[model samples]
Target chain A: MANVSNETRPLSPHLQVYRLPLNAKLSILHRITGVALAFAAILIVWYFLALATGPEYFETASAVLTSWFGILVFTLSTVALWLHFANGVRHLVWDTGSHLGQKASNRSAMIGLAFMVVMTIITLWIAIGG
Target chain B: MRFLTDRKRVEGLGSAKQGTGHFWEQRLSAIALLFLVPLFVLPFAYNLGDGYEEVRAAYAHPVNAVIAIAFFVTVSLHFFQGVQVVIEDYVHGRLGMILIIAMRLLSTLFALIGAYAVIRISLGA
Candidate 1:
């Protein structure tokens, strides 16, 4: 009541003050990855347009994507993709009414994190070698 | 005929069903992408860096073409939904409304261009 009484009273801590839990961390990671992938929408669309354009344009797009910077971005995007995927699965599971507790949430986050790392590693290996 | 102030109307604007509709869309596309991504990405990665004709031949298969189109549409829709949530959370006022519409247009563009590309290659046009 006292806190509500004064408009300028000290407020609850925000992002700066709170040390977020593992689940919270992974939850935000999901949003970040989503945004990253949203941007990659342009790249994927570009790939298609380039292919449809002609051989020369396709080659140019291919070269740009296979370049070092492109590879770096792709790697990060792929990591984000898997991160989002794994956490998304966690969300699906949670929606089913299981894994709803604090401890369980953290454990699930760890599992999802592990899954993301393994999948990302294998995919990157294939992407690089193939 | 009921005339209500803009503030009164919008302040309680939600019909309550909108949230469920949004959730359903998000989940449905998510489930679709769960399958479509693997279907689309595997062949795409496999064909990456291939010659134009070779890639075109791969996409010429109806299955590949269909998957490409479905992937594009679902991805853009899901993206539009996700970015709407993002923008709503981070932005406010008329600017937020404008950005939401922009995201809609952007998603539509992504779907259109992607389908066009796939269709052209698929038909050998």
Candidate 2:
């Protein structure tokens, strides 16, 4: 039998052992939201295709898209889009050799999150009509 | 007899060398989208509740059609690059290669479809 014991393994910093800082957490979320937005992009393409296909197809898409469940998914994706976009802008700023300090990075991350929330609310308000 | 230094000859032979191009393309597309996304999304959000004809007419505008096409193209390219990085980081071996290829094909197909749809709408067809 092979010796397989947890005590023999060296400990590494992991989610259970260490708490990630806000900036680190947001950075991870940025990648996740980016992936989410990618899937949403596929849905957008399908919607456009439906629109171009004909009135019947467009009506079907519109109906499904405006349903309660559909709107819920759409709103969630929209929020992800804003978060990804805001964090991406923060990344671009860092790429320019500025704002690389921890303080600046943390501050910008907070601002990015706030911006995402405000933008998502505003866009959704405009979209849902009120 | 060679005039080139060893360092110069080996400059682009490593992994970091190849990553520069991918990184720059992502940044360029990101910048393009930073502007074009707002342009596309604003009109799109405004037209959310519009009917078939109204939405079609909105897309028919030259500026709207052009921006929509640009947005589709840039976003697809960016999405492909971003997902490729994700796959490279998390996936390995034959599966990673297959996934990367699939991502490339899917993003390209979606981009083309989106562009064609915009063109069709703009043409009043």
Candidate 3:
């Protein structure tokens, strides 16, 4: 308490100073995926609208979505979707006052990441193979 | 309104009195989407490589149309609230207020357009 003063203090160590914990990393990923999903929502809405508009518009939208680049973007988005979703469930659990400990939180994060990868692969296979 | 002690008045009650409402909405939407998303994605995945007419026909089913509409509404609401929390956390002052407004409008627009599209296909219009 003696050293405390009114002078401007330097900022504490931040992103550059420390490696984030697993849960923290996953939390950041959740925010990122949420943002990505917002953009994906626009594309999805547009797809539906094109279908309503006419066959020509539908075909155009479909063509773009089925292209290689489109497929890549979609694949990533799907992965993000699953990751965000799984992490969301973890959040809901925490909200209910369960799984609040560091061990449980970290475990949940790994599980969510695993779920994301497995689901993405399965969905992609089904989609591409159909 | 006159019976409460100061501690009782001040302890648990939030200033806005609406935080629980927001929390419940987010959780309820999350629960709905947990099931609906998988259901929605299955048919969507099946129709991935299909042509325009086929895809439209798939969505033309009454059941498909209804689920799609539900998915759109719930997702838009959930997305709006979720992003609003993020904005409130990281942004401040005039910018945050503006963003919250923009997000609300955007989500509403997407929901409206999505519902219209689903209805159009379902009715074979």
The better-scoring model by lDDT among 1 and 3 is 3
RMSD in angstroms between candidate 1 and the native structure over all alpha carbons? 5.4
Clashing pairs in model 2, backbone N/Cα/C closer than 3 A: none
Better of 2 and 3 by lDDT: 3
TM-score of chain B of each: 0.86, 0.90, 0.89
Candidate 1: deviation at residue A80, Å? Answer: 0.4
lDDT of 3 by residue, B16-125 (tens): 56537788888999999998888887678778768888989989999999999999999999999899999999999899999999999989988999999999999989
| Per-candidate DockQ vs. reference | 0.50, 0.64, 0.74
Off by over 4 Å in 1: A1-14, B1-19
Proportion of true inter-chain contacts also present in candidate 1? 0.50
Docking class of 3: medium
Candidate 2 lDDT, B1-125, residue by residue in tens:
99999878876766756636788899999999899888987677777657999888888899999998999999899989999999999999999999999999988998899999999988977
Judge candidate 1 at residue B61 and give its lDDT: 92
Which lDDT tens digits does candidate 1 get at residues A1-130?
Answer: 6465787777787978889878878888889899889766688789889989888999888887788877777888878888898888888888789999988988888888898899788777767666
Reported per model, the fraction of native interface contacts reproduced equals 0.50, 0.57, 0.79
In model 3, pairs of residues that clash are none
